[model samples]
Every structure is written in C-alpha cells, then in structure tokens.
Target chain A: MPRFTAGDRVTVLDLGKPGHVRIPWFIRHKTGRIERYCGAYPNPEDLAFGRPGLPAIDLYRVHFPQTELWPDYPGPPGDTLEIEVYDHWLEPAEPLT
Target chain B: MTPEPIGYSADAVDPSRLVVEGHEGADYYALMTEAIHKILLEKQVLAPSDTDRVIAALEAPNVTWGARIVAQAWKDPSYKARLLADGSAAAREMGYAIKEAKLVVVENTSSLHNIIVCTLCSCYPRSLLGQPPWWYISKNYRARTVREPRAVLAEFGVAIPPPMEVRVHDSNADMRYLVLPKAPADAAERRFDDLVRIVTRNMMIGTELVEPYRDRG
Candidate 1:
C-alpha cells in the first residue's frame, strides 16, 4: 500500500543516506501536496551499488508553492514547484495555520 | 632535413592547416565507445544488429511528433484529457513505445504556465521528443529556472503577464514533464498540418507560446 495519496500534504525527510539519492536538498523538510503517484520504482541507492533492488518504493509527484521553496522567489504568488520524491523520504505534514 | 620546396612544402602546409575543433575529444569518446561495443559484440552480449537498430531509432527525426500530438489535443478534448491524465500511455498511442521513465503533461492556460527543468541532472523526454536542446541541459538553466523562472524565461524572449502563474517543474527523479502550451486562436478551424507548424520545441518547453504560422514574404 502507498504511504500517501493524491492531495495529501507531506514533508520530505531530510535524512542523508550515502550514495545515489533521488531526493534533492532544496525540498527537504518542505511541505507540499501529492499531485499524483508515479508508481513503484526500484531503490536507486541499492541499484547503484549492484545489489538486487527489491521491494520497490512508491514515488509521488509533490507540488509546492514557489514561496514555500524559496523565500525570495521572484515568480507570482500562485507559482508552484513540483518534484518527484520517493515514499521513504516523505512523511505526513502538519496542516498550515 | 631533406631538401623541400620553399614556397609550399607538404609538411609546412600540413602544419599550418586548421584541424577540426574538438577532434581529439570526439576521437577519444568514439574510440572508447567502439572498444566497449567491440567487447560486447565479441562476448555475444550485444548483437551487431542491435547497434544498427539503436542508430536507426536515434536518427528517426522528431520534427513533427510533438507538434502533431499538440495539434490533435487542441482539436479533440477527449484526447487532451487522456494526454493530461497519462502522458506516457498517450504517447504510446502515437506509436512511441516509451518504456523507461514516465511522462507527465501539464497544460498552460490563461492564468497558468508550466515549465520543466532537471536541477540535479538533465532528465528529459528523449524517447518522444528526441534529444533535449543544449540550453535545456545548461547549468544556468537548471539553477536559474528554479530560483527565478520568469527572468530565465524572459531571456528566452518569453514575458509572462504578472497575472499568470508560472509553474516550474523540477524533474528530479524518474518522471519527465512536458508543457502543453495553450493552442493559438482559430486552432479549431486550422488544418492539422497548419496547426502543427505553429507548435515549436520552445513552446513545448514552456519558454514560448504556440504562435500562428505566418508568411513573411
């Protein structure tokens, strides 16, 4: 079962694992809504080291407001940024005030 | 030294002649790739015909593939819905069997525009759109697009109105994105081929809009 569904707010985990992680540093600890599930994919970290990549992880496309990502973002207030993140790196986010 | 003609000796002309730029670099990679290919061929890991097939696929032009799809989507709302729902599967309907990374199509509207970038690396929809443009893979584009998309887009000669929101998609993982720019006026009345001419690669990248074809002459 997937950890998150579409429209669910989530925050990317800031945990640093060695070697070949798909999670970018910029989106760590940032809150966003899951746009959609991108299906399960093999763990790239394990696959990079020649291990048999088993138990695929679910990936989700998370959409975040540009303001939430970069404080000084020059784009409009409604401008958004979307990124694909693996399930392990995301956790349920608290609701905004 | 052997006696040579003073006006134009073969060695002198050869030394003075301009050589191809990046020749050594190109040759180095070519040799390395050839060596790898030869070893794989010798071990029967890759058949000789495999290279031919890959070359053929690479050589297959992407001149009208994207345009045709965009035009079709404009003419048919149902097709547009499917394209927005499942971009990869929709592409497969057009005979492009995309088996690697998934594709997501974002539509541009009156108040919303979508642009694609891969900050970590250049992950593009190569199978359907062929190779990405050089500027799309540049470090400047990757870094700036996320920070200030409007400014970067302006450099590309695209100026988005303040009322419109520019959504920048950072393709950080396996999923690729394609911007579905809004169709030009009279798109429904235009012929498919005529509509195709209006869509450009830049438009699909969200750096520009689909302009109506015009004859300057």
Candidate 2:
C-alpha cells in the first residue's frame, strides 16, 4: 500500500538510469505536494518489456509551483505545478535543514 | 524467394525528383486483416460477420466520455471541482469507469494556462475519448510543444497576454489528460448546449478559447 495521499509532501528520488524514464527529467530532484491519487498501475520499467501483471505502484498527483520547476516561470505568485508520479520515484520529504 | 524487381530502380528517370515508396502488397493487407480478426476474437466483442461493421464503426467518430465530462463541467462547477480534485470519482459519477482509460484533468486559471501533449507517443484516453487529431501525434508538435509552448500556441493563433502564463502538460504515462479551460466571459449564464457549441474540441485542448459569435440578425 502507498503511504502518500493527496496534499502530502514528498521528495522524488533520483533513479540513476541512463535510458528514458517516464518521470520527467526536470522533476527528479524536486519536492511537491500531492494533489490527487491515481490508482495502482504497472511499473513502467516492467511494462516496457511486455511484462504483464507487474507489481502495482501508487501514482500521486503532485503540485509544484511553476517557479520551482523552471527558473523563468512567469506566473502569479501563488501559481502551482501539478504532475502525477509513481511511488518508487518519491520518498517522504526530509525535515527542513 | 528471389528478390522481387525493385519497383523504383535507382537508374530509372523520375519526374519531380520525389521518391515514392513501394506500396504494401495484397498479402500485407490479408495479414493485417487476419491480425485484426484475432484481436477482435480475443476481445470477444463481435462475431466474424460483424467485423466489417466494426471496421466501419471504428472509422466513424464516436462521442467519448472525455467529451462528456467537458460538457458536464461547463454546466456544473461542483462537478468540475470534483473532476480537478479526483478525476476517477468524477468520471464514475457520470457512469464511466476509471479503469477504462487513465484520465487526468489540467485546469486553466486566470494566472496559469495548461496544454496537453503526448511527447513519446499518442497515448490518449481513447476509452474516454475518441482518437486524437493527426497533429497531436506529429513529431513536430510533440518535440516542440514542451520547449516552445508559446510559439506553438502562436502558430495555432492563440496569443497569451503578458499577464497570463502557459504550462505544457505532458501526458506520457498510461494516464491521459483533458484541458479544463477557464470559461469564457458570460459563459456561466449560457445554456449547456450553447456552451458546448462554443467549446469546440480545439478549445478543450487549449489551442483556442471559446469566442462569442456575433448574431447575424
């Protein structure tokens, strides 16, 4: 079972694979708020090779402010960036340093 | 089998200097038909005689659940919020199963705008939506939309004001996206059907916004 839910804060981990990963390249090291919970899905790595019935993974709809994702995002101050991510790609956010 | 004579020999003179690729032979069509038949059989949705009918039906455009949700959102704010908050539940309320297609909704607000793209492939919500536009799958659009969103929108004649910001939503996972555009001015009081007419498919994808049409009379 997934630990995160909508509105939960989490940090995405950096999986050091060289080839294409479904998680956006820009978002690997960012932290965001979960906005929605997409139900269990087959892990992309397993599905890529036609493997069926792969282990179910949690999908979270995360929201990051536009400014956080891009250096030059020109939206209003409160604007947010939202995206769906799988479980393995994220970990609980560390306490503020 | 011996290699068949090359249809377009390099030595042959050609007009217009364009190279025409060889066409698929009869065997290719027969194999394709058989493959389709096997798929239909596995799905157990139709009889062998009904294959032609199914083919015709597939060719015809059908109203999809995604379009239905957009239409409903135009009429009800509560439903729209549900859609933005929890797409699966919102779709379930309208009698659509989330399992049918992975559905996601991107909200367009006063400060931030959203657009959808399937950068890797045309991974659209077909069960909830019919096929995507030919342009949606074009390599040009996929590669360029994320990096140069404003320019792409400009090409589509959509200009973003200085105060407004654009965000490109990449639908690369099994999940698909629908652009929930901000309702046009005075749209709240409009009838549902009239609003649907104004919110064309292009507008739903964020390439255009609903503009009030002038009355001819």
The number of the candidate with the highest lDDT is: 1
- List candidate 2 segments past 4 Å from native: A5-11, A14-20, A30-33, A65-81, B1-68, B92-99, B212-217
Q: For candidate 1, write residues B108-214 as lDDT tens digits.
A: 98778889999876888777778888888777788789889999988987877777778999988888778888988888888989988888888888888765223
| C-alpha lDDT (0 to 100) for residue B154 of candidate 1 | 85
lDDT of candidate 1 at residue A80, scale 0 to 100? 88
Model 2: per-residue Cα lDDT over A1-97, one tens digit each: 6678777788877776534467765566778888777788887777776777377888877777656765675444444455668888888885533
Ten contiguous residues minimizing lDDT sum, candidate 2 chain A: A73-82
TM-score of chain B for predicted candidate 1? 0.78
- Clashes in model 2: which pairs? A64-A81
Candidate 1 DockQ, CA atoms: 0.28
